[model samples]
Target: MFRIPASNNGLYLGSVPQSAAAKNGGTLITLDHDMATLPAVGRTLTVAELAEHVDDMAGRLWAAGIRPSERVAVHMSPGFDIYVLATAVARIGAVPVMLSPALEGESVAALLERLDRPHLLTDGAKLDGPLADFPVADLTDRTVVATGSRPGAVSLDDLAGAPRQQPVLLHPDEPALMTHTSGTTGLPKLVVHSARTLRGRFRPQERLASLVRKRETVAIHVSYVHSRMYLALAVLLPRAMPLVIMNDSEPAGVAELFAETRPGFIETHPNSFMEWEELVDHPRRPLANVRYFSTTFDAIHPSTMDRLLRASERRAPLFFQIYGQSECGPLVGRGYTRKNAHKADGRCLGFAMPGVTNFRLVSRNGARPSRDTPGYIEVSTAGRALTYFGEGERFDQQVHGGWWRGGDVGYRSGYGCLHLLDREVDVIPTIHSTLEVEDTVLGRLEELTELVVVAGPDQEPVPVVCTRNDRPLEAERWRAAVADLTPMAEPVQMPLTELPRTATMKIKRIELSQRLRTQEGRAS
Candidate 1:
């Protein structure tokens, strides 16, 4: 019953080939922006073919000099290449620092510098562009590798010439993976995870697996660089469930793909779900076959939930909204149906995931013994990350005793369900709860897609809204929406796509506010 899985090598990689061998391989789609490319369209592989590919990549990565505790920065878009290459690095016990393409070049260079400019692996586009941001003097000290040609970098294809080698195993506490947090409030910091912390997620993934019937098709369009994504793939791909992995969440593209696959379970970021809500009007009704909808990373608006459930044809389709952070895998989970979606309070995030997490509230006055009094959220979770890479002192600051500070302000309802108000840094000095006010406005208007409250010039609550169909904001509707609450600044309209976002789709309030202030200065 005991499994001695290779460290840093996601366990599923070792087991998937064996489990899938001698059987029809489940589908693995690598949906990317370049739909015309070979890696984009769905690639169907037999278990043997999948096994062969993993082995080949693993061997190549070992040949590339990726060794135990080595850091390899991955600077590619999410797709088959990224997944395979990152896994290959893990196979050799080198930690893959998962970086997002959406990250700005300046931030990327700064983060690389902070990480001590570890071995950089990127593509032709990044080598000549993003990578150019680093100081010229620094390039001489680091080994650069990329798929296409670069003056000083080694060609990735050269790895094929080097002999293949078996994976290097390490202790459970050794570093295995590294990814940056969303950085909604400040510069993103790298978070490191070891087999010890990562193994805790295995049980929850297994529990999630039992909920889905064996062999049911799964369609996933979420971030690959996210901390839990590798673990998720480790569990799902090996289960032999046919999969559709998408990077581009464009409504028509995803709808067309789902029409052909007819996936039973659909999992994506909450924002993607909202983006896909337009599929409700699609002639094919893409979500009709979906039985379960899983959303993680942040709280979702009730309207977004309502639109999606009504579109699904299932009689009792369940929507799982997960509330937690990358530092901690998942602290709480709550499910809502069409009937209960509208009934949900704006803040009722969820109850703790059983046997996996322990949570408490530390108020300004200290620990709160009762419910409904909002306070700083804290948790002791089996799945918490080991530390912030290069910032062990910062990691120590967030922990008190054995509990990890969640950096959120929320309270437990009388029924024990959690209600998150605002992130500690996002809090406004409004007479009312800033997030509660945003939720109230959301409930009042059906056409409003998203509303975020940020501090304005006078330090008052200023609401930024993304309206459906890009409709003009009506002052009357806005006035009525917040009529009973504290007087607030007039709403500022913003296009949803223009909003600065973390990889998970959570808005960057501080960034957007600063941008707006700069624009105002120019106009005045």
Candidate 2:
């Protein structure tokens, strides 16, 4: 068995592939789609080959005038190349600020302004689409297009074969990368991470990886801009597990790939897992080989977990649910087996990682924190981000005496499980937990593809429901499902695609609430 490398200083993304190659050069990495940056390389690669590509890209970036300590904002089209380009920027000791391609131009422009004119790496599609109205030149120091070029922009494709420079390692405490929050509330915050904090995030996940006793192909579908993507790679690569990185989350495509690869371990966004529930009954039995399934981005329904766990043919398959945010890495998590998955409570997000993470429930109004009066959840961990770029005071406001309150309000269970109720901003006075109602109703309604509870225009609880295939929801069925729960407004049925989502597929509850209010006003 391979042991995790000592990371006392921190993990440097520039050298991750190189370090992995040294341990297992032939370890294979499979991709669902081809890389736009290196189209000639094809879809399958080995760790050694991946290292060369990263090295080459680093050289091209250096040739284009990127220097240590400068910020390179990567806001290109969605693909595996996003991760490659980000690592290349880090190789030159420069900070790679990742902006989701899903972000609107206004938000992107605002973030770039906050960066104080950082270099931008984007493509033709974004420039001509959402960002069409923005003055690209004024919002950025330099615009480098990875796919198509503009007159004043630099073409990353043209920088091929530039001289490769030696890798530079920044101090462990120095800013190494920047990733944005989910932006569920409003504009996303650019979170700053040091190499040391990244190492802190890596250690707990490495321990989780150790649970697999044998070598297994690992499949991951994660947002390239999220810090979890890099940490997942860091954990799997050195262990030399065969890797499958998927760019498409379409159920049909996912089924075909999983059938071929038969990955033994899988980790993806919780919403993606919900979407993939249809694959459970596919003829290919795509999930049959999966020994472990995991989600860290959001709260997953027990029903979804049960469906997936039952699909796995492996002996005693496990589903690992980790509760975390962009500001901090995996804080608390628990694993579910087939025996208890169907009966599991969605709110009990499990306990902290034994030695690396710890959490507390701070009373909001001088009362005992419980299900009725949930307290603010705060955590103490080395994995916390340093500060929000250009918003130090905003970041400071969340940190109280070294413990970070991430705007979530929850309480600990009698047995020590952390029960996440709702985001502080999303809570409604009439409902104990909007999320809890959603979880219960969703568990009862198999037809629902998605369900979100938000405050209505009149302060009533509104349930926005999305059914599979956009089929009209049966009003009677929805009524039956929520009958035992608290009273709520008539369910608002909408297509899942129409719902506003963050890069991680989380519903923008606040935005949805406002939209509902606007629609109500328009109707009146």
lDDT values of the candidates?
Answer: 0.74, 0.92
CA RMSD of each candidate after superposition: 3.3, 3.1
lDDT of 1 by residue, 1-524 (tens): 12345544334333345355545464454343442112422455444555666667666666656566778888765565566667667766777888887787777777778778687767767656766666633732345454545676666566655676666655667677888899887788899887667777666666777787746778877677886677777777667777777777888788888888888888888778878878988999888988888877788877778778888897788888877788878778788899998767868888876787778777855667343457878888877888898899999999999888878888877888888888878777664467777767787887787788888776788889988888998988888888888887888898888989988787888988788788778988
Model 1 lDDT at residue 449: 76
- What is candidate 2's TM-score against the reference? 0.98
The C-alpha TM-scores of every prediction are 0.92, 0.98
* Model 1 residue pairs with clashes: none
Per residue, candidate 2 scores C-alpha lDDT tens digits across 428-460 of 998889888888888898899989999998889
* Model 1 stretches astray by more than 4 angstroms: 1-43, 46-48, 136-146, 366-372
